[model samples]
Target: METLLINEQFVSQFKYWREGQVRTGMRFRRNLFEYVSKFNHHQRHHAFDLAWKLAQAGKESIVTATSDSYTIWVNLRVVCPAALPSWSNSGLEVGAFEPASPGLVPLEAVLSA
Candidate 1:
Protein backbone atom coordinates (compact mmCIF):
# COMPACT_ATOMS: atom_id res chain seq x y z
CA MET A 1 0.00 0.00 0.00
CA GLU A 2 1.06 3.55 -0.67
CA THR A 3 0.92 6.25 1.91
CA LEU A 4 -0.08 9.79 1.01
CA LEU A 5 0.97 12.69 3.16
CA ILE A 6 -0.74 16.07 3.00
CA ASN A 7 1.31 18.88 4.43
CA GLU A 8 -0.09 21.97 6.13
CA GLN A 9 0.91 24.21 3.24
CA PHE A 10 -1.01 22.03 0.80
CA VAL A 11 -4.11 22.11 2.95
CA SER A 12 -3.86 25.88 3.41
CA GLN A 13 -3.50 26.58 -0.28
CA PHE A 14 -6.27 24.14 -1.13
CA LYS A 15 -8.59 25.89 1.29
CA TYR A 16 -7.81 29.20 -0.35
CA TRP A 17 -8.63 27.79 -3.78
CA ARG A 18 -11.75 26.03 -2.57
CA GLU A 19 -13.02 29.27 -1.07
CA GLY A 20 -12.38 31.14 -4.33
CA GLN A 21 -10.07 33.47 -2.51
CA VAL A 22 -6.83 32.90 -4.40
CA ARG A 23 -6.67 36.66 -4.95
CA THR A 24 -4.26 37.50 -7.76
CA GLY A 25 -2.82 35.54 -10.66
CA MET A 26 0.71 36.09 -9.42
CA ARG A 27 -0.13 34.61 -6.06
CA PHE A 28 -1.79 31.61 -7.62
CA ARG A 29 1.18 30.94 -9.87
CA ARG A 30 3.59 31.34 -7.00
CA ASN A 31 1.68 28.97 -4.75
CA LEU A 32 1.34 26.43 -7.52
CA PHE A 33 5.05 26.52 -8.25
CA GLU A 34 5.98 26.32 -4.62
CA TYR A 35 3.75 23.34 -3.92
CA VAL A 36 4.86 21.54 -7.07
CA SER A 37 8.51 22.23 -6.37
CA LYS A 38 8.31 21.05 -2.78
CA PHE A 39 6.42 17.92 -3.74
CA ASN A 40 8.88 17.12 -6.50
CA HIS A 41 11.90 17.65 -4.32
CA HIS A 42 10.57 15.66 -1.41
CA GLN A 43 7.73 13.33 -2.24
CA ARG A 44 8.28 12.80 -5.97
CA HIS A 45 4.66 11.93 -6.58
CA HIS A 46 3.61 11.32 -10.14
CA ALA A 47 0.57 13.57 -9.96
CA PHE A 48 2.74 16.47 -8.85
CA ASP A 49 5.31 15.62 -11.50
CA LEU A 50 2.61 15.75 -14.14
CA ALA A 51 1.37 19.04 -12.80
CA TRP A 52 4.86 20.47 -12.91
CA LYS A 53 5.30 19.40 -16.50
CA LEU A 54 1.97 20.85 -17.51
CA ALA A 55 2.69 24.10 -15.77
CA GLN A 56 6.08 24.35 -17.44
CA ALA A 57 4.45 23.73 -20.82
CA GLY A 58 2.05 26.63 -20.15
CA LYS A 59 -1.03 24.45 -20.29
CA GLU A 60 -3.93 26.88 -20.24
CA SER A 61 -6.36 24.06 -19.61
CA ILE A 62 -4.69 23.43 -16.28
CA VAL A 63 -4.01 27.05 -15.31
CA THR A 64 -4.40 30.53 -16.74
CA ALA A 65 -3.24 33.74 -15.15
CA THR A 66 -3.36 37.45 -15.73
CA SER A 67 -2.25 40.50 -13.80
CA ASP A 68 -5.51 40.76 -11.92
CA SER A 69 -7.08 37.32 -12.04
CA TYR A 70 -6.35 33.64 -12.51
CA THR A 71 -8.08 30.30 -12.98
CA ILE A 72 -7.01 26.80 -12.00
CA TRP A 73 -8.65 24.09 -14.00
CA VAL A 74 -6.70 21.24 -12.48
CA ASN A 75 -8.23 19.35 -9.61
CA LEU A 76 -5.59 19.67 -6.91
CA ARG A 77 -6.88 16.60 -5.08
CA VAL A 78 -4.84 14.52 -7.48
CA VAL A 79 -1.67 15.66 -5.81
CA CYS A 80 -3.23 15.69 -2.35
CA PRO A 81 -5.54 12.72 -2.04
CA ALA A 82 -5.56 13.01 1.71
CA ALA A 83 -7.93 15.93 1.25
CA LEU A 84 -10.42 13.81 -0.67
CA PRO A 85 -12.58 13.05 2.34
CA SER A 86 -12.88 16.70 3.28
CA TRP A 87 -13.62 17.62 -0.30
CA SER A 88 -16.28 14.95 -0.69
CA ASN A 89 -17.90 15.74 2.65
CA SER A 90 -17.98 19.44 1.81
CA GLY A 91 -19.96 18.62 -1.37
CA LEU A 92 -17.28 20.04 -3.58
CA GLU A 93 -16.33 18.71 -6.97
CA VAL A 94 -13.92 15.96 -6.07
CA GLY A 95 -13.65 14.85 -9.65
CA ALA A 96 -12.89 11.21 -10.49
CA PHE A 97 -10.60 9.09 -8.36
CA GLU A 98 -8.08 7.05 -10.25
CA PRO A 99 -4.90 5.67 -8.82
CA ALA A 100 -1.79 6.98 -10.51
CA SER A 101 -0.34 3.49 -10.55
CA PRO A 102 -1.60 -0.03 -10.06
CA GLY A 103 0.37 -0.35 -6.87
CA LEU A 104 -1.11 2.84 -5.45
CA VAL A 105 -4.18 2.29 -3.31
CA PRO A 106 -7.24 4.50 -3.42
CA LEU A 107 -8.02 6.81 -0.54
CA GLU A 108 -11.39 5.22 -0.01
CA ALA A 109 -9.85 1.79 0.19
CA VAL A 110 -7.24 2.95 2.62
CA LEU A 111 -9.81 4.61 4.80
CA SER A 112 -12.09 1.61 4.73
CA ALA A 113 -9.24 -0.67 5.58
Candidate 2:
Protein backbone atom coordinates (compact mmCIF):
# COMPACT_ATOMS: atom_id res chain seq x y z
CA MET A 1 0.00 0.00 0.00
CA GLU A 2 1.13 3.51 -0.76
CA THR A 3 -0.34 6.35 1.25
CA LEU A 4 -0.50 10.06 0.50
CA LEU A 5 -1.37 12.60 3.15
CA ILE A 6 -2.78 15.92 1.98
CA ASN A 7 -2.53 18.57 4.64
CA GLU A 8 -5.16 21.11 5.57
CA GLN A 9 -3.63 23.74 3.33
CA PHE A 10 -4.61 21.76 0.25
CA VAL A 11 -8.19 21.30 1.44
CA SER A 12 -8.66 25.06 1.73
CA GLN A 13 -7.42 25.50 -1.82
CA PHE A 14 -9.73 22.75 -3.02
CA LYS A 15 -12.70 24.54 -1.49
CA TYR A 16 -11.61 27.69 -3.25
CA TRP A 17 -11.49 25.81 -6.53
CA ARG A 18 -15.00 24.49 -6.03
CA GLU A 19 -16.31 27.97 -5.36
CA GLY A 20 -14.49 29.42 -8.30
CA GLN A 21 -15.99 26.83 -10.60
CA VAL A 22 -19.46 27.59 -9.33
CA ARG A 23 -18.95 31.27 -9.91
CA THR A 24 -17.60 30.69 -13.43
CA GLY A 25 -20.66 28.61 -14.40
CA MET A 26 -18.44 25.57 -14.90
CA ARG A 27 -19.47 22.33 -13.36
CA PHE A 28 -17.22 21.34 -10.49
CA ARG A 29 -14.24 19.61 -12.05
CA ARG A 30 -13.18 16.24 -10.78
CA ASN A 31 -9.84 16.21 -12.53
CA LEU A 32 -7.06 15.00 -10.27
CA PHE A 33 -4.92 17.93 -11.31
CA GLU A 34 -7.57 20.36 -10.19
CA TYR A 35 -7.55 19.07 -6.65
CA VAL A 36 -3.82 18.44 -6.63
CA SER A 37 -1.69 20.54 -8.88
CA LYS A 38 0.92 18.81 -10.96
CA PHE A 39 2.67 21.97 -12.05
CA ASN A 40 4.39 24.47 -9.80
CA HIS A 41 1.77 26.18 -7.68
CA HIS A 42 1.11 27.18 -4.10
CA GLN A 43 -1.01 24.08 -3.57
CA ARG A 44 1.57 21.68 -4.92
CA HIS A 45 2.98 18.99 -2.62
CA HIS A 46 4.87 15.76 -2.89
CA ALA A 47 1.81 13.79 -1.91
CA PHE A 48 -0.12 15.30 -4.78
CA ASP A 49 2.63 14.46 -7.20
CA LEU A 50 2.66 10.81 -6.18
CA ALA A 51 -1.09 10.54 -6.22
CA TRP A 52 -1.32 12.06 -9.66
CA LYS A 53 1.33 9.78 -11.04
CA LEU A 54 -0.29 6.70 -9.60
CA ALA A 55 -3.65 7.75 -10.93
CA GLN A 56 -2.29 8.35 -14.42
CA ALA A 57 -0.70 4.95 -14.40
CA GLY A 58 -4.09 3.42 -13.64
CA LYS A 59 -3.31 2.32 -10.12
CA GLU A 60 -6.32 1.72 -7.92
CA SER A 61 -6.66 4.05 -4.94
CA ILE A 62 -9.12 4.94 -2.24
CA VAL A 63 -9.60 8.54 -1.31
CA THR A 64 -10.85 9.75 2.04
CA ALA A 65 -11.50 13.45 2.29
CA THR A 66 -12.40 15.34 5.44
CA SER A 67 -12.35 18.92 6.62
CA ASP A 68 -9.02 18.33 8.31
CA SER A 69 -7.17 16.51 5.56
CA TYR A 70 -7.32 14.28 2.47
CA THR A 71 -5.82 10.82 2.42
CA ILE A 72 -5.18 8.47 -0.50
CA TRP A 73 -4.15 4.87 -0.33
CA VAL A 74 -2.92 3.16 -3.49
CA ASN A 75 -3.04 -0.58 -3.81
CA LEU A 76 0.32 -0.84 -5.53
CA ARG A 77 0.93 -4.40 -4.50
CA VAL A 78 -1.53 -5.69 -7.01
CA VAL A 79 -0.06 -3.71 -9.87
CA CYS A 80 3.44 -2.66 -8.93
CA PRO A 81 4.77 -4.15 -5.74
CA ALA A 82 8.36 -3.16 -6.48
CA ALA A 83 7.41 0.49 -6.28
CA LEU A 84 6.17 0.22 -2.72
CA PRO A 85 9.54 0.66 -1.01
CA SER A 86 10.23 3.86 -2.92
CA TRP A 87 6.90 5.33 -1.89
CA SER A 88 7.41 4.17 1.66
CA ASN A 89 10.67 6.10 1.77
CA SER A 90 9.01 9.33 0.69
CA GLY A 91 8.49 10.50 4.31
CA LEU A 92 4.81 9.64 4.44
CA GLU A 93 3.57 8.52 7.84
CA VAL A 94 2.58 4.91 8.25
CA GLY A 95 -0.50 5.21 10.39
CA ALA A 96 -3.08 2.65 11.35
CA PHE A 97 -5.18 2.04 8.28
CA GLU A 98 -8.60 3.64 8.42
CA PRO A 99 -11.24 2.14 6.15
CA ALA A 100 -12.64 4.62 3.64
CA SER A 101 -16.14 3.55 4.65
CA PRO A 102 -17.58 1.75 7.62
CA GLY A 103 -17.34 -2.05 7.78
CA LEU A 104 -14.88 -2.22 4.90
CA VAL A 105 -11.43 -3.66 5.53
CA PRO A 106 -8.76 -2.23 3.24
CA LEU A 107 -6.75 -4.98 1.67
CA GLU A 108 -3.58 -3.62 3.17
CA ALA A 109 -4.95 -3.90 6.68
CA VAL A 110 -6.05 -7.43 6.10
CA LEU A 111 -2.72 -8.46 4.66
CA SER A 112 -0.76 -6.72 7.37
CA ALA A 113 -2.66 -8.56 10.06
Q: How well does each candidate superpose onto the true structure, as a TM-score?
A: 0.20, 0.36
Angstrom error of the Cα, residue 100, model 2: value is 11
Model 1 lDDT per residue over 1-113, tens place: 12223333232232123233231111233333112211123233433444455445443223232232222333333434343232121222223322223342333333343
Candidate 1 regions with alpha-carbon error over 4 angstroms: 1-7, 10-43, 59-113
RMSD of 2: 14.5
Please provide, for model 2 over 33-78, each residue's C-alpha lDDT reduced to its tens digit, 9 standing for 90 to 100.
2222122233235546667666677764434344534444554234
| lDDT score for residue 14 of model 2 | 19
Q: Which candidate is the best by lDDT?
A: 2
**Per-model RMSD to reference:** 16.9, 14.5
